[model samples]
Target: MPNLLIIEDEAAIRRVLSKILKEEDESYQVDEAADGVEGVKKIKANDYDLVLCDIKMPKMDGVEVLQEIQKLKPEIPVIMISGHGDIETAVDTMKKGAFDYIAKPPDLNRLLNTVRIALDRKELITENKRLKRKVSKNYQMIGESEAMTKVKDMIEKVAPTEARVLITGENGTGKELVAHWLHQKSERAKKPIIEVNCAAIPSELIESELFGHVKGAFTSANKDRAGKFEAANGGTIFLDEIGDMSLSAQAKVLRALQENKIQRVGSDKDIKVDVRVLAATNKNLKQEIADKNFREDLYHRLAVILIEVPALNDRREDIPLLITHFAEKIAKEQGTQVCTFTNKAIKLLQNYNWTGNIRELRNVVERLLILGGKEIDDKTVTQFSGK
Candidate 1:
């Protein structure tokens, strides 16, 4: 249902407007105000979707009322009702943030159409804000351990600069979380952050995947396609699991880094791109270079700033916080009651060998929440957490 308010000093006009709107749509909950003072008071005490104010009024004129609404609750769309002589003033009100204006003898179709459009726009704005909050919550960091503090401090220092970062950590150690934080805090945060799992793509197509390909470049190349570099142009490209990238593809990435340009797989044409590079890996790049499996030049280019994410076992102090975070997340996802863990249960979990790191811990937390009691305790941990 949409809530609407009409602020008109004339009792007869207010009654007729309210009657027409209600008959047009019974879902409209319309409220009336004798003057701008009463209207502003109603506004401050309620959450209205739309407001219709008359240009000519006493005590508080429509212009002053509109200004107050702008300062108080600007999101509510205000449509000015204008008399024949108030046409110019109505247009002036729009310049001061009025959504639109209607003439004194309002056209039935125009009044309803404008109201519907304004309500739709307000709904879209509310939905967009909701989605943004959800996205931010998904990427939230939930740790205050000394090791995590150092990593966060490094991010705060390096995020504002145009430096390439190489993040190294064991498997399942939340390396991707660090990558997301870096991108979100950078100057290019508004642009997309493209992630490529080098190990997941076949070695035969790695170059084309990173640099794109022209039509007829390969047997499966039916059409031209843009790759990660082109897609992330003016943004950040996160090469996850960089250790598994082929030696040949590494050469092209090296060129892109050095010259800020890339060539399509089967085309000699070079495309310039302004991209910040961030790479992550579980393997030792130094050892890969020594074994001739990785290029030393690319290592130097990407490691201008190095961030090493600590394994869960190394930061045991943060495990309790992580469990609570994961528990609330899982509960919300499953649409169930949020679960809590006893101190003994949290301590038991913290003492385990988290060889698979944070990823494995999240899985265990979800499993326990499903099978254990609402209040998770040491017995539940021992029985359902599988140590």
Candidate 2:
């Protein structure tokens, strides 16, 4: 049931209004306040989906109540009710942030219609907020190391602004996690976080992948397609392993970064884009630049805020915590009870070389869960971990 608050100074008017709303729909749980002062108190105490307040009241007026509610609970929709002379005041109340207005001597149909519309609008606003939170949850970072802490701190500071970010780390070290953090903390979290692995795509197709192509632009371009940049409009685009991108593709990427414009591989028309580019690479771009394989200008452009993720070997202290996290996660995925690793097993894990880093550790933990006994021990480590 949707909670409704009616703020009318006159007790008789409040009762009549409540009766009409309930008759129209019993699903509405109605509460009444005699004056704006009492209405404000009720609003402060409980959360209501909709409020119906009269324009003129004693001790406080509807407009004052609306302003206070706007400060305290802006998401709750308010519909102002006006008397014969207060219709003009109700119009002004909307300027102060009222959802809609209904005239006094309440017209049943008008009240019902306005209430339905206001409730529907509120539902949409709430649903949009819920979806956005789900998007943020998709990018949850799962580490407690100092390296991750510093990366998170930087993301908090940089995500609000449109800054180019370059994430550097070894393979499986979670450079992509840094990129996700940047986008999730950003003002553009509501937008898509489009990811393109430059190394995965063939050099011949990288241009079309980043800038998109029109119909018949190339041999395989049967239809007009939007690329990563267009898909990430008003949000962020993450280019992974960018150092391995071809020189030809690098020039086009640099053009997109510098000019905020890109042309399709076989088309001459340029399209404007408003995208925040975040690039990551396992290779050393500075060395690649020295060899002339990577564009020096593009490297400088992308590295405005550089974040380097440390390898698991360097942060061995976090391995025990990480192991437990992955164990619980794997247990849930496999529909089994959470398993525990012995202290000796964790110590052995810390001593091993994590050349493949955190990604490798997660895989190793999953293997232990499946192959090892209820309690993962040092002997189980040697038997299954391939250490």
lDDT of 2 by residue, 304-338 (tens): 99998888888888898889888987898799999
**Tens-digit per-residue lDDT, 170-251, candidate 1:** 9999888888899889998877677899999999999998988876899997546677787777888899999999999999
lDDT of 2 at 305: 92
State each candidate's clash count. 0, 0
Top TM-score prediction, candidate number:
1
Per-model TM values vs. the true structure? 0.66, 0.65
Q: Please name the candidate that would achieve the greatest lDDT relative to the true structure.
A: 1
List candidate 1 segments past 4 Å from native. Answer: 1-137
